[model samples]
Target: MHKTKKNKKYTGKIYRYTMLVFVISFLILNSFVHWQMQLQKQTKEAKATYTAETMVQRIETYLNQYQTKSVLLKQIVESDENMNMVKFETLADFIIKGNRALRGIELAKDGIVSEVYPVESNAQAIGLDILTYPARKDYAALAKKSGEYVMAGPLELIQGGTGMLLINPVYTVGAASEKSFWGFTILVLDWDTVIEELNLDGLDDSFYHYRIWNMDIRTGKQNLLIEYGDDGLKDELLVSCDMRNDTWYVEIEPVNGWFSTTEFLVNSMICILLSLFFAVLFLQYAIHRQEEFAHHEEMMRAAKEIQEANEVKSRFLFNMSHDLRTPINAVIGFTELLERHSDDEKKVTDYVKKIQLSSNILLSIINHVLEMSRIENGKESLNEDTESVKELIRTIDAVFETTSRQKNITCEYHVDVIHEYAVFDMTKVEEIFLNIMSNAVKYTPEGGHITADVTEVCEKDHKALYRITIQDTGIGMSEEFIPHLFEPFARERTSTESKVLGTGLGMPIVKALVELMGGTVNVESKVGCGTKISVELFFEIADGKRAEESDQKQEISSTEGIENLAGRRILLAEDNPLNAEITVTLLEESGLSVDHAEDGKMCIEMLHQKEAGYYAAILMDIQMPQMDGYQAARAIRKADDAYASIPIIAMTANAFEEDRKLALESGMNDYIAKPIRMEIVLDVLKQWI
Candidate 1:
């Protein structure tokens, strides 16, 4: 009876313990499954964020490249003396081929579609007036009015396809804020091509949904530009892009609403083993956290670098504004005063001199900055011509003589050359000497001494090496700063140098110019002692035959020998009314007969109407309507008329070496840059007419 009672109590205890273990296991499994689901959700969100961000970056990069191409086209058009329709068409075709999204490019002159690329395909768009068209007028007006790039819809097109159009307005800036709208450059992008390039259709399988909304300035509403996947997703990641004059928003989310099939399977397999599930889950969570921290750190570093670059750019702009405005303000103020006091002879002379001084300073600043930019962009090249070495030195001395006298500084120049002439770019050589000498004069204290020395180093095989040294007695620089002297915008930051007015571009430009000319420059200085700079250059010695030709040419270039200019008939082709009037007045005052042609077409018509050799020469402005100077020159060259061989002198504002070469290539006998000097015009006339 006692043994039976003991066995029954033991069995009851076992049953209770078994029931408690089973209940605990069930509760633990439920918790594990819930935790796994949460892990899966977090992984999916992370993946979606990464994928969406990557796509956004890619899209932005693509758009930026296209934008760059558009901007380049605008620059080309603005810089061209005459816009050649054929050349523009070629450029457009190249762009379209390079970028699959671009369907066509169109150019408008004052709202009229004057040119379009892929003529066979886009012939219908060639004559369409952008301002008069109902579908395009709004965007065209917006772009012109805002003077900024305007992006318009994936709207239905006249060519039976949908496309997005980006319109950019080109304007010619007049004095002050007065802007004359030049025209419009249009970039037409196929909507389907854009979608494909952006891979919007493939984003669904990539586990993300995307929606793009562009704020329409016209409607004052946000219109959907593109959308992919379901809009009903609960969680979505959003990114905003600031386009010029418009705002665009891009929203993205996971297709499965934060649920991931891969993560679910991974977690489920681990959960089946129960014991290993917790350990593996914890390990994975730690690893993921570590990766996230690393990614955050990398992002922070990149952001910091970008911020630093932006800060540098801001500082550069500040410096440029201050430097550029100083001389410009002086020029403007002095000019206004001179104009008002024109009646007083003595005051007029003094004011005019002051204005000229200020103008020279402003031009110096502009030239330095532009030269540096050209050098950095690898566009700078030497245009060599036979020049007298002594003549060049004399010109330099004349330039600085007055400045030195005003400052009471002793300025001396010396040259020792075996040959009187050399094949060199005289303009570049003058710049090299003037920049260095100017620096010396600027840095030297009042009554200090500045000296320039040029000597022939060696001569071999018709090439001569020349050494130039410029020394200044002024507050000098430390040895440590000498190494960085050739860097752009690098200046001594000492109190003694703080008040000095400089563009900080002189030394760098000098260095680049010297290097470009196959030369070397060196500097020696001790703080408070003085500074000395030496440059060695190689120049080809001009042969006797070329030298004689140059001398004969120079003789003909003189205005003194010209006695029959009054009998010469000249045709001036100019578009701007103001420019035409000024040019005509100047020419007539020089005792020459002047006839004006409003455009290249008119100029050609006038030439064709007149008898052969009736006009002595044609002074052509490069930019004109109906036709441009280049095309006119070509047409005249091809004409059978005797006047076709008459001198065509290109008077243009495009004043670059490349411009001169192009002018020559286009059959122009001579080229003169505008802001036209009467003296130069007379000289050109004396030579050609």
Candidate 2:
């Protein structure tokens, strides 16, 4: 009877403990569920905020770079006094040059399409009447007629891309208002480069649905141009950027963000788990409630630790990356300075080569970190449009040409398949080509053959498919590792003797770029044999013509074939002593007489001393002491029968929009950015003098 009473007491205690445990578990679980929900909500808002911030930053960066490039170009165009080239020809050259200069803007100079840069694959734009295209001809016409800068709609530039166009008029000296002489200088850029790069850097891959639109707000509804993944996405992120005359909208819908049918099951499982544990405790024996509570507490603590560690690591890496670029920038900039001053041809070449190599290395590191970040986060994809295959191949060849020569390798190039220009990003393609071609040149020994070829595949109606093959008789790869060729950070194990070294992001980037361009890359290799990398792409353009003929031809020789610089009056206004000396040496080599000035005041003094026409052209450096070039030039313009009407060309390194404006406003005609190339200087002199 006493034992029975003891058992009853124990059972009652167990029941009381069980009830207490249920109440504690209920509150804790409820808190956890609420926190998880809040966490998810916060994650979504954070992602959107981050994406928007990053997009805006990149847009601003690209625009600033492009603006700098454009101002430099306009400065050059107006100052070229000796340029006998017609306005049409000038416009042609400027377009091609401008496109090369600007990195990420969708470009269109509506008023004129020059033949120099010509219409390579302008099938989408060449015809179909710009008159009918509201954005192109109409706004461009107004800008040209009005002699002012005009911005157009965020229109679809080609079949694969969205961009904005900027048009500005070119007027004569005495022209009133914006409506003046010469055709318009149109600048167009596809925004996808930075946009997609940002997307690659941000989004996770398994994301079920995403939609991106280059929004046009004409009819109250947003126009979706580039949509990805799905139309079924519920929660979304919308970001706006300044697009031409208006703004661009980018919307992101992550699949993981939305509650799926699978999610309902997950929530059901949670409910079942809670109900089963508590319900069973009531029906069955209630025991060890305290231990179970302690275990749940332990698990939560562990998860918190792991999350904190990961966050710390991410912050560290981001800070390290931020710190890295500063030193790299200094190195690159200083090396450029050294290269310009080095008068020894061989030394100059070697220094330039090293600079290029260093730049490429830095670029590779940046790309690697960026790719890793993107891959880890699951959002790396390509949004490629048509690019010049010829330009890409030529750049690759040029990059390795000197290296190949040093190794005594015969670098043969052939284009059989690339009949028409297709869509792709030049920067990404350049990176891929650099990686591959650099490897080829690095690994191949003397007398080895390295051939680059582009050929055709089976074609469909009116569109011809093409394949680009780069085959190198360098140290070959093993057959065992062909599958992992496209994988990140995997260098071929078999090519052990190959001196070529890389961050292993090369092939992966190439693969990504190819996929982005809507293509495939296949590698075939044998031990002790050679490696063949075949990249296949789709290409078609109406009236398509291959660029192989011209691009593959002899490159523009760097040396200016001038007889003499002696007796040729020259003006030099420069602040940097090293550059000035180098310029003097280069000019002396061409036998040119040179005059020097420290600032605009001195230049004006030099001009005043001479009677009518003293110097061929005043090389007025932009930034200087005691009446800067701009102010001095203005004074020269306002000279009362004293200062000569000399052809004053700006010769400074201040390459920016405002700089160009101030330079032009000060009465100087031409402007040149620093880190001066001798060829550009010579050409400038020849054109003016």
Candidate 3:
């Protein structure tokens, strides 16, 4: 009996241990499964949000292209109030051919369709009155009343289809110079074509169901523009974007719900098997934790990067505001002073000089900002041309001559280049040198010494590497700040506190332009002693023919004196009356007669009516009403008259190098950037005429 009782006790112990093990395993498996499900849910949410954002971006981008095209049409119509069928058809054809999403472009006069491009297919749309149509009238009236582009549709077209319409109102100047509504420029985009271009249908078929929709402004009801995949989208993610006057929403959801059933089942089976061995289950759990930690680290890194970008942008804006306001304030204050002391000639002269200095500062800031933007956008490029190395060094020295002399600073330039002429982007090279030398002059105190050394370091494969080192005895930078010196909008605290006038974009632009040319820039500085900057750039060696050609061109560009401008009559095409008056006054004061035309069209007409050789040259402004300078230049070049080849110089505020290139390509003899200096004007005229 005692033996039997002992055996029963052993059996009871075994049963209890087995039950405890099973219970613990079940609990562990359940917890792991729960964790996995939650992870899957989070992943789906992130993916849905990302997909919705992507869809919105794609839709907005596609629609914005068409909207921009419509605005161009509006500009054309407003410029030429008498726009005929041929011109309209030509412009429309160009736009449509460039963009495949466009179904047709139409023009409406007094709310009636008067013209349509691709006339054979959209012939029925002609003569249709959009004002009388119930489906289109509201948006058309909205566009006319608001004087902004209005988006409408997925409505049936007169040509028997469905499409979206972008309507832009056209306004023209009446005889009294008052604005009057001309009509509308309408752009039609087929829905299916846009969808295909944006890959919306592919997204629906691949993994997620989506809906693109908007709220009807008139009805205050949900209007579905596009729907794809399943009927029901549970727990959908929605994102909204604004286009012109409308708000568009993109909603997305996984087709198989948030969590995949097959993945869940597979995970559960793996977890159950792991539970049989506690150590294996623990290892899996640890690995999962490690993966989660890694993911969190990645997310934190991304967040940090985004935060840094925002901070940089904020700093740039702050510096821009301060820099821009300084010169503007000076200009305004000096102008007021001049007006108050109008009768005092000395005070007026002083104030005018100050205003001119401030204007120069303002222009410098604007140019730096534009240059930085071009660098950031990867739009800056090298326009390699044959340039004299010696001339380049001399130019930098000449540019800083006055400033350095006024400061009592000694400037020295050393050149050891073997090749007299080499192919390089002369403009960018000049910009780099000027920027460096300007800073040196601005920072250096009186009696400071500055030296520039240029040497041809090596030559191989028809390329010569040139090294330029500029050293200055100035208020140098701290070693810590040297690392950030090439960053955009980076400024030293000492410079800012001293009220130094700069946009803080010079060094950054220099660095970008250098790197763009496959060059290197380095800086070394001491706290109170001095600073040194070194740059190395490669240039292609120019052959004898190129060097000879460049020398000939340079020789032709030189002129005798301003006296040569006497007795010359030139046509000035400027839209702004104030600018025209200023230019005319300046030219007349220099012994030249100036005839002013209000716009490009008038300029062309005046040229045509005048006898050949009556005008010495033409000064054309780029942005004008009726027609732009490019159009005018081309028309003059194509004219059947002796004066058609007359010298035309573009004088405008489109001051980039590309603008100058375009002006020359448009049949202009030369270009002069505005906020014009009289010396430059005289030099250009001498070269061309």
User: What do the candidate models score in CA lDDT, each in turn?
Assistant: 0.76, 0.60, 0.81
**Candidate 3 structure, TM-score to reference:** 0.39
Model 2, position 75: C-alpha lDDT score: 49
Ten-residue stretch with the least lDDT total in model 3 = 553-562
Choose 2 or 3, whichever is better by lDDT.
3
lDDT digits (tens) for residues 1-689 of candidate 1: 77567656655655555455445554677578778667666766666666655666666676777778788888887666268988997788777886877888989888888788877767788778888787788899988887777778867876669888888888766669676888888888888888787865554445666777876655667788777775554677676766655666777777666654655564455445553444455445444444445578785776578779989987666445533554455556556556556789998887676666556555655555556678778887777888888876766664565567656799888899997788887766666776687778777888899888889999988799998899999888899999999877778874364566665666777788888888999999998788999999989988898888767765654345346577688999999999999999878876788899998999999998988878999999998999999999999998887977999999998877788898899999999987787767887877887
> Candidate 3: deviation at residue 292, Å?
59
Deviation of model 1 at 424, angstroms: 2.0
Every model's TM-score: 0.43, 0.33, 0.39
Error of 3 at 327 (Å): 14
Write candidate 2's Cα lDDT for 216-255 as tens digits. 4334566564455645657776666664444666666666
Arrange candidates by TM-score, highest first: which order? 1, 3, 2
On the 0 to 100 scale, the lDDT of residue 107 in model 3 is 93
- What lDDT is reached at residue 45 by model 3? 75
Q: Residue 599 lDDT in model 1?
A: 89
Which parts of model 2 are misplaced by more than 4 Å?
1-432, 440-451, 456-467, 471-532, 535-568, 588-592, 623-645, 653-667, 674-679, 682-689
* lDDT for each residue of candidate 3 in 424-474, tens digit (9 for 90 to 100): 987677767767877787778889999999999999999999998899999
